[model samples]
Target: MKTIKNLFTALLLVLFLSAIIIACKKATDDPQPTPTPVTSITSIDPSTAPVGSTIAITGTNFNTNPASNTITIGGVTATIVSATATRLVVVVPTGAANGPVSVTAGGQTAQSAASFTVAIPSVKPVKEVRGTTFANQNWKKDTVYLIRGMVYIPADYTLTIDPGTVIKGAGPELDPTGQNISGTLVIERRGKIIAKGTAAQPIVFTSAKAVGQRAAGDWGGLVLIGKAAINRPASTSFAGGVRGVVETYSEFDDNSGTLQYVRIEFGGTSQPNAPTNKLNGLTLYGVGYNTTIDHVQVSYSSNDAFGWFGGTVNAKNLVAYRGFDDDWSSDWGYVGKVQFGVALRDPAVGNPAGSNGIESQNFDPGENADGPLAKQNGLPQTAPIFANISNFAFSSTPTVGLYQAGIFLSRNTAISLYNSLFYGYPEGLHLDGTATGTLANITSGALDLKGIVLANTLTPVVGTGVITNDLATAYFAGAGRTNLIVQTSDLASLLFNGANFTLTAPNFLPQAGSPLLTGAATGGKVADSFFTSVSYRGAFGTDNWISSWTNFNPQSTDYDR
Candidate 1:
């Protein structure tokens, strides 16, 4: 009886302990916490941008994955560049309307307080423009501008010119007798330009004078100066407090700007009868490799249509039409790359001091041609590579000044011209002056003009002592196969414009049965991905690259207000 009574008391004690433990557990337990969603945009940077431009959007509660986030500009779907919890990068969509920019992420949406403005294509009336320093601003495609003075875009700023934007220079007439005070757009060092125009609507720079009165040197043309490698005289960088003049850049590729599908007409000013103080349709000074310049055309330029001074920029699809001087000039140690270009010369427009499709030299006439030698101070000795070019002297009665040629290489220039065509020039390829160093490169296979075709040239090759016309022709002929000196009639189907070389409606493509169609090499220095390899010896292949985006008729369009 005593054992049973003790067991019952123990059981009751155990039950009471169990009940207290259960109550304590229930009191200590807490509920799971939930986070609130955030849906707000604090701010936006560069609230305005054109189509196909990048813009940064900042806000809260953005998904980490860019694919999970949705962004729209002006109600159009924008391309997401990157995404994070606090920031997002997107490109303004094409054909986007003007409206609020919105973002939707993780089932939450946020709209910016300020609406994004759509860049409208507004046309401007003709008037005078230029002579002021341009700030860092976006020049929209809304209206055309008349540049009357020397307009400067200083460093730390960008001048964004939209496609279809017409900029006319009002110099000479705007400020007559003041040559230095021309309507010019100068991009100083550290400044950048992003003018990517399309073929259908290209960016045009022309004279402000009426069509009937317009002439070359009406005003200064587009000049781009950058901090890139150049072989200038020692210790001559940014001297004289000049804003645009730069000495050199350490890098091969410097990100300065882009100029694509652009046309400059009636530009290039000079003194009464000298090549001094002249400008080009497009001038690149110490430009870097990072710059993108292609699909450009210059017409009626008094000097070189496109000139380069000490830079490593690469260009393609260039057209120099009816220029008075050299179509393409390189000096001051320009070691860039050029391919697929066309130069059509009109006898009515030219000079007597030796005009050529290409004029290459290591330095200016006064500077040391071999000083610092080649590749000194990170500057190559005016060694340029020209491939797949078409140079046509349209004038049947070619009056060459100072021995004109399809190409002129002098002053110790180590050049490579391949897969090209030269027609109607006084001399197909002329190498003048003292160039002992450059000649060695030819024998060493470092400098050469292979697979070239010279049609109707009075003299195919001209060079210094030992490299006379006969020696040049023999050396070039023995160097490789596919080099030819043919008659103009043998080329077949190369139509001409009005009197000569106007090329109003040119068909540069050779006939199917022509030997030039199959004489091109498949591999070479220019056989990279950036360049399209063709089986033809000229600039044109099956592709019509010069169509649509280029402007051949600058005289008909009235760009002034």
Candidate 2:
């Protein structure tokens, strides 16, 4: 009986304990203590941003503790304005580049749930056109300019002309006796002049008259002054032949000027009686070696095209055409190198009835004892005349296309003509100076008749040298025409197949079978990628900026581009 009573009592106690244990478990499982609910991430404005633009942010989620939780924009903290659970505003840092924004609460970081992007602006085209004037008397810089009767560049001022800029001259036609805008340009005081131009848009210094109506000797030509080594005869005086009486100055490496792709037309002779009044395209009085000249064309000048008084500046890609007197005339102390020159005669025009392709020398041999044509002023003693004259065809008429040049190296001017084609002239190449001469100078010796072709159309002139048998045979072949025919497909392959020629303008392309398409020899220091084809020559190759020969006329009003 005692054992039963004890068991019952133990059961009751066990039941009570079980109930208590169940209640305790239920209380523990009720609900996780509500978190303090720290308001951190507020609100972000302008989810997107532009490069260099400001961004705004607002929110109270930023920590309110000392030093506050970091609210960064593009990794940089923003200027925290009002801070609250629902309001936190900050101006976007200016230097904050483009990226994401982060907000940190306590130690936890809330990744930029909102993303932003940078924007780009658009491009516009040129619409304004204005002319420059020299009316203001502001001569702080050592420069010169001219718009009308006003002179911006004084005789001693250095001038800088940007490429593709057109400068027009006004006033009388060559007669400088009357007060007009025809005064000579004197680059005294070692002043520098920079005229930079490109192949497509050459810097043109021309007269105000229309191109067709414009006459030679219209405006004064470019003049450069410098001090450097020059090539002159032992007996000749420095300033004997030139017509102008320019002031004297000396400067070596006159970091003054640069000229490229410049075209000066309808200049040369002026004041028929006054020789000093004539205009030469580019006249260098005492230019130094620091100046540069390339891809320059002086056409339809009344007198000589180019004349160097004294200097050592190299020139290349020079074309002189339709001049009344000599094409490339150099004399007084000129000691520079000229390469890739093309002196073409206008079959329609003639100079004093008869003249040759090129007329140059260390002295003005034809005019006086120091003239380029004089025997004493011939090559070997004069400055070294290194030129690459090729693919030239003179006029067929004796008055125009006589056996003059093809190649004329008179007065022993140390010159070398290689891989050149001369046609129509009675003489192929003339070496008449009292100096040593050689046939090896003609580059046709090494290659079979494939490179240079000289066709003598007129009766052979006695003084000019004879063409080599190989060159004559190779050029004439069977028809006697030395013209090289380039196919259209071949030109396209070279220009368009690769990145050789980029067609920036609308209609620039070489005509099929054009002579200008022949390629220059490989070894020469000619421009490698000037033309698209391996056979194209001259300034332009093939693109899409020019019209067909039949459709395009020089008299047309439409511009090329």
For this target, which candidate reaches the highest TM-score against the unseen true structure?
A: 1
Model 1 misplacement above 4 A: 1-123, 126-129, 132-134, 175-180, 234-244, 271-275, 366-375, 395-397, 401-403, 433-435, 488-502
Candidate 1 lDDT tens digits, 1-561:
999999999999999999999998887785657778786788777777677668889889999899899988877898898988999998888888888889999798889989988664334655344554557656655566777556777778888888888888876456533544566677777789888899887888888787778888787788888777777754653311224445546677786789999999888775332336677888888888899999999988887899888778899999988788888888777877888998877766677777788888775565555432546567657777778998888446455563388888777677778888888788887865444555666666666777788877777778774466665667767845467887656544443223235556555655456666667855677676666777788787667788787656667655532
Instruction: Please tell me which predicted candidate would have the highest lDDT against the true structure.
Output: 1
lDDT of 2: 0.48
The true-versus-predicted C-alpha distance at residue 297 of model 1, in Å, is: 0.7
The CA lDDT of each predicted structure is 0.74, 0.48
Write model 2 residue lDDT over 100-150, tens digit each, in one string: 777776566765556645444332221111122222222211122222321
TM-score of 1: 0.72
lDDT for residue 144 in candidate 2, whole number 0-100: 20
TM-score to native of every candidate shown: 0.72, 0.51
Per-model root-mean-square deviation over C-alphas: 17.0, 17.6
